[model samples]
Each structure stands twice: as structure tokens, then as C-alpha cells.
Target: MFFASDNSGPVHPRIMEALMEANQGHAMAYGADALMDEVRARIRDIFEAPEAAVYLVATGTAANALALATLAQPWQTVFCSPVAHIHEDECNAPEFYTGGAKLTLVGDTDRISAEALRAAIEAEETRGVHGPQRGPVSLTSVTERGTVYGLDELRAVTAVARDYGLPVHLDGARFANALAALDCSPAEMTWKAGIDAVSFGGTKNGCMGVEAVIFFDPAHAWEFELRRKRGAHLFSKHRYLSAQMAGYLRDGLWLDMARQANANCARLVAGLRAAGMEFLHDPQANMAFPILPLRTHRRLHEAGAAYHLWNGTLDGDDPDQPIAARLVCDWSISSDEIDCFLNLLRA
Candidate 1:
């Protein structure tokens, strides 16, 4: 049972087929390929933003860093939760890409409240020119803890940023998963909710490897293009990336994949509950943080199950100590596989 990460899942057949088709003939290099035009148009239609600026990159880091570099200045600070991917996971790429701008962690948890965000933003840029000025607010949905943000929660934090006249960037690495769980359209979760830019992810859903950076305001397009090229993220053989995203969006395959992953996570959560496991947070999308006894963890590990431990190590004197772990379900994990994992837990 492979539950290490969604990134470890196999590429979907449709996406692979599309890549095969894209290899049939010669195509223009860089972003000039015809497939990219189609991909851009399709995304625009999906997001309901006719004038939005769309570009593709091979990794979420490139998408987030380049987009933020375009939106923020060097002398400012980006406000985000302490566990935001841009802050904790990107290896300071946002800081480097934004020309030395810093990240001011808004709240101590995966989810940030509007009040906490207001307090954080107000606390910055107070010392004349010595302090960092406020830049953009980056929000992550389907937060690191597996809790999905509701519409009200998203609006509340965005409104706080609006109060400070700062632009808002959404680190949507799990955008599809969040949309599936929330049962909302792309527009409702993003642009309509006051997000200025978004890293629309497809790699973790079912694509081979592709993420799109979308700016609702088209004015940022040229600057983003320059930044992307400068950062070495502009793929010379770009049609492959276009093909993956094209297949992902085709016939709403992205949503179907996300729905299946979320359903798998829900199934796993129910089994964990039946096993009397304590949860670190409610499972909302494809990830869960459950606390199990160290003996159970050892047993699962011995049985060849794959996942990440969030807290506590297996080398402990207390076999009954609670250990927290992160379990993720991808679109490709079967129900039978989930049952096998549950059976292992019960054993």
C-alpha cells in the first residue's frame, strides 16, 4: 500500500496518452506551441476569467515563486501561515525569487484567522523605513494539517489583507483536492474570493508533472514571463507540460481524480475511527494526520506499509506511546489497497 505521498502515484493513462500524441511531430519550442494555446484557453474557460494570465511550469515551487515575485517587491514581506508550503517547504525559493523579500508568518497553525492576520500585518512596517513593508498575503487551502478552509474563512483572511491594501496570492498546491472537498467552482474558491494570483496545481492530482500560474489581473503577465524565464523554469520542450495539463482538464478529469482521492481519504478516516485511533485533525481532502500507538506503527512498518511519521520515533521504550503520521491517498490507490491497510492497522 503506497500512501507516502500523492507525488509518488503513477501518471494517469490519459495524460500519458496525450504525451504520446504530443511526441508525434515537431512543435514550436517554449510557450509558442499550439497545445499551450489550447491549454490556456481551456483553463480560462474553466476559471471563468477571460482575461486571466496563464503560464505553465514543471514544479509548484516555480509557479508559486515566479507568481509571487511578480506580485511582491523586494522591500516587502509576504504574510502566510507558519506551515504554508511557501514558507516551510519551498527552501526559501519565495524569498530568493522575490529578491530578498521576507515571509512574516501570520499564525502559529496551518490555518490562519482574520484577526491573527490583521495583528501580524499591523505589527510590520512600523519603524519608519527600518521595518519591512507589507506585500502580499499567501493563503493555502487544504492546509498542511488536512483541514480545508471554508468560504467564510477564506474571505475573512482575504478581507484582512484587503484592509491593508495588499495583494493576495493563493498557494494552491492542492487546489483540485480543496475544490473537490468544498464542492465549489474554481472561480468561487479563488478570484471571486479576492485571490489575485494562484498556483493551480495538476501534478499532485493526476498529471505527469505540471502546474499553472494564473493571474486574474492580466497586467502582471509580462513581468511574470520575464521572472519565469529568468528563474530557469521556462521549459524549452514545453509541449509535454501542455499535454499533461490538457489531458488533466479534458472532460473534467482533474475533478474526477480529486473526487476519487478525497473519497479514498474519507474511507481511510472511517477505518481509523473504527480502530479507535486519535486524529490530529479532521481529514477533509486526501490527507490525514492520525495518532496511533507505537506498536501499531511498528507493526505497520514491518508489514511494508509506506507513510511519513509526523511525531515520535519508532525507537522508543514505550510501545503504547501515541505517534502521529501523515497518510495521503492519490487517485490511483485502490479501495482494496485501503482495506488491506486498515486490516493491517486492526491486526
Candidate 2:
């Protein structure tokens, strides 16, 4: 019943074993290890991008910030949804890494529309040197609100960026989850959709802590390498990161984990519907945003269930009032756990 975050879940056993094996002998440091070569090649094959430049970091924030820094200049502003992870959750790391580049909120919703993005891009650079110039467009899949963009939607947004002669960056912090839900190839969701770079995330799926930043064109490879090192995100024992990703990608473990997570979310959604809860967003991938009665929330809390309250606290006067809850299901969440949670809600 611990739905606090996928971040709290345990690392997959295979990933842990891979880490143990990687620690047995000496290896090159700072991403020069042989394991890193396998990771690069594997990601390239997965994305059908042979020339893509792939680099690993310990956090999704570092991945997004460095990738954006490579695509956008300091004098420019990045366009993104108002609730994008890069905007709301990254703590301005993107601005810092881009050397003061600004973030322009494109739409009021968690998902940005093509029209909204075009208007936002046009709104920028209208003042010429007086205001921030238009930079790269960043789109988040499996958006903060738990909804995903279809392939057509992705193409539309990226097409809008292309019209403005802007590169597009995808903040795919839940890349595997989105891919599982969309049932599309990595290429279709990214480069094929006109994305210039992607923050290929792994941590929120099943890895311990590793995210890959992949540039489809490879033109900004050196710049990204320099920025990563300068940003202090370069890991000395880099093989550890490599081993985790290798184990994750091996035997399609990444997809399997994502499938299980998405299935768990669907199960939870069904249970929530049975309990007569209202969803704040469509349940997609591994996340669900639902509004439950305050009385139900209090029961769950008293039963030691852990999860995040998205909108309101439990101290309100009306016990029947509805408040939003963000429930995240990882690969490890069991049917029994979800059943227990559902049973509690029913009670």
C-alpha cells in the first residue's frame, strides 16, 4: 500500500546483481568503461539512432538540464507546458545549466498543444533584443498529470517547433512507461517525431538511479560532455551506472517493468472507479490522479497507507469533501497490496 512514489521502490534484482558484478574488478572511470559501450549501443539500437550521442547521469534533472543546455543558448528561452517537470519540478536547474536561459510556459494545461506552442514561440523574439529570444521546445510525455501524448499529438507539437526553426527536447523521465502505454517504437516517439534530443529516463522505472541524455543528431555531443563534467554530474565509478542500464535493457526488462507498472495503475484505476472516486486526469502509464472523499483519505492514512496529496490536506471540516491524490505504481507493487488498498477504500 506504499504508493508514495516509484522512487521508493526497490531496485530490480537483476540490476543489483549487475552492479555487484561490475564492482568485482577494476574498470575505466568517467564513462570510459566497456559497460558504457554496451549501454550506448543498446540505446542506439533501441532508438534506431546509430549516430545518437548517449550519456548517463544520476538524476533526471541533470539529464534534462544538460540536454537543454546543449540545444538552447543562454540568451534564449525554452518553451514548455506550465506543469512540465523541467518547469515545475527541476528547481530551475535548466535555467542554471543553460546559463540563464528562460522557460516560457506554453499552455495552461499539463500537456501543450501545437497551437499553444506556436503562439508561445511567436510571442517570444517579438521584442528582438529587448526580450528573450525563442529557443528549444521541450515536451514532456507521461506528463505531470499522468496523461500521455499519442504519436500524432507528439508529431503535431514537434511540427510546431520545427515551423519556428527550433529544436525540440523531450523530457521523457518516464520514457519506458510512456513507451509501454503507447506501444510505439522509441524512434516513433522521438526522432521520428522530430525530437532533437531526449532525456531517456530509467530511475522512475526500475533502476537504482541513472538517466540517459541522448542527442539524435550527435552535433552537440562534445558540448554536452563538457557541460556534464562542468555540472559535476559525471560519475567516477561510471560502470555502475552502465551496469544498471545494461541490466535494465537486457531481456527487455525495461519494457516488462513498465508493462507491469501500467497494468498496476489500470488495476488501481478500476478499483478507484468501483469506489466511486473521480479522476483528475486520465489514468495513463503508471500514475493516477484521483479525487477521493476526505473520509476515505482519512481511513487510508489511519491504516498507514502512504501517498501524496496533490490538492488538499486532511484537516478540512467536511469529511465528504474531495481531495486529489497522486498514486504511483511501480513494477514491484503487488496485487495483494493494491487489493488491500481497494478494500480499505471500500470499507
lDDT assessment of candidate 1: 0.93
Clashing residue pair totals per candidate (backbone < 3 A):
0, 0
- Model 2 segments beyond 4 Å from truth? none
How do the residues 214-311 of candidate 2 rate in per-residue lDDT, one tens digit apiece?
99998899999999999999999999999999999998999999999999999999999987888999988899988988999999999989999999
Off by over 4 Å in 1: none
Q: What is the TM-score of each candidate against the true structure?
A: 0.99, 0.99
Question: Pairs clashing in candidate 2?
Answer: none
lDDT of each: 0.93, 0.93
Q: Could you list the CA RMSD of all candidates, in the order they appear?
A: 0.7, 0.7
Per-residue lDDT of 1-347 in model 1, one digit per residue for the tens?
88999999999999999999999879999989999999999999999999999999999999999988998999999989999999889999999999999999987888889999999998998997998999999989878888888988989988988998999998888899999999989999998988999999999998889999999999999999999999999999999999999999999999999999999999999999998988998899999999999999999999989999898888999999999989999999999999999999998
Give the distance in Å from residue 15's predicted Cα in candidate 1 to where it truly belongs.
0.2
